[model samples]
Target: MNLNIKILNQKEINNMKISKKFTSIFLAGLLSASVAFSTPA
Candidate 1:
């Protein structure tokens, strides 16, 4: 039971880490895209 709880906690932590990484990447892409679009052609 304890081992299962530990594994679940680890999975949650890993998922949080992945989500943070994905958010950062998504934000960066959005920022770059906005800058490109806003630039005068």
Candidate 2:
């Protein structure tokens, strides 16, 4: 049981890291898109 809990915790930690990376990438894309729209070609 303890081993299972540890495995689950590790999975959660990995998921958190992935989500944080995805959020940062999403934010960066949004910022760039807004800047692109605001600037004149």
Instruction: Assess every candidate by TM-score.
Output: 0.73, 0.72
For candidate 1, lDDT tens digit of each residue in 1-41? 99999999999999999999999999999999999999988
- Relative to the true structure, how large is the alpha-carbon lDDT of every model? 0.99, 1.00
Candidate 2, superposed: residue stretches over 4 Å from native: none
Q: How many residue pairs clash in each candidate?
A: 0, 0
| Model 2: colliding residue pairs | none
Report the lDDT tens digits of candidate 2 across residue range 1-41. 99999999999999999999999999999999999999999
Q: Which residue pairs in candidate 1 have backbone atoms (N, alpha carbon, C) closer than 3 angstroms, thus clashing?
A: none
